[model samples]
Target: MKGKEILSAIKKDIDEHVGEKVLLKANSGRRKVMVREGILEKTYPNIFVIRVEGNDRTSRTISYSYSDILTQTVQLVFKNNNVAI
Candidate 1:
């Protein structure tokens, strides 16, 4: 799929999961892989936010743009099935 189409679909799925729990897997570098379970907080025009809880039980929000998802820097998974956008 074209980049734009893929981005749009990702946005749609994010909208559907707002306020629901999902897994976010991000790879910033070879040794910087991050996997967190969070609630899909919201979807913005150019970005989406997730509310992740830390080991200490503190919650924080992280925002990633569509470009991030499109480039595979961030991946969203629900119920073990990766949301392929």
Candidate 2:
């Protein structure tokens, strides 16, 4: 699929899991990997956001471009053990 098509699909996938917990797996791009469990916050035209809370009780928002999903640079897992994006 083309970029726009893939982006649309990713957005739809995210929308489906709104208000649900998901696993976000991504490489920090510096040889380190980061994985977080958070609620699928919201989806935008260009990017989607996740709400992650650290052990210190600090909540942070992380956003990723749709391309990240398409390239598999980021993986999103639904609570049902299904891969969303």
> Model 2 over residues 7-37: C-alpha lDDT tens digits?
8877887788888899889978888889999
Candidate 2 accuracy as TM-score: 0.88
What is residue 75's positional error in candidate 1, in angstroms?
0.7
Per-model TM-score, in order, reads: 0.82, 0.88
The most accurate candidate by TM-score is: 2
Clashing pairs in 2: none
For candidate 2, the lDDT comes to 0.85
lDDT of 1 at 13: 72
Which tens-of-lDDT digit does each residue in 1-77 have in candidate 1? 68778888878877877787788889879779899999888889889889999999999999999888777898888
Give the clash count for each candidate: 0, 0
Q: Could you say which candidate leads in lDDT?
A: 2
Residue 26, candidate 1: C-alpha displacement in angstroms: 0.5
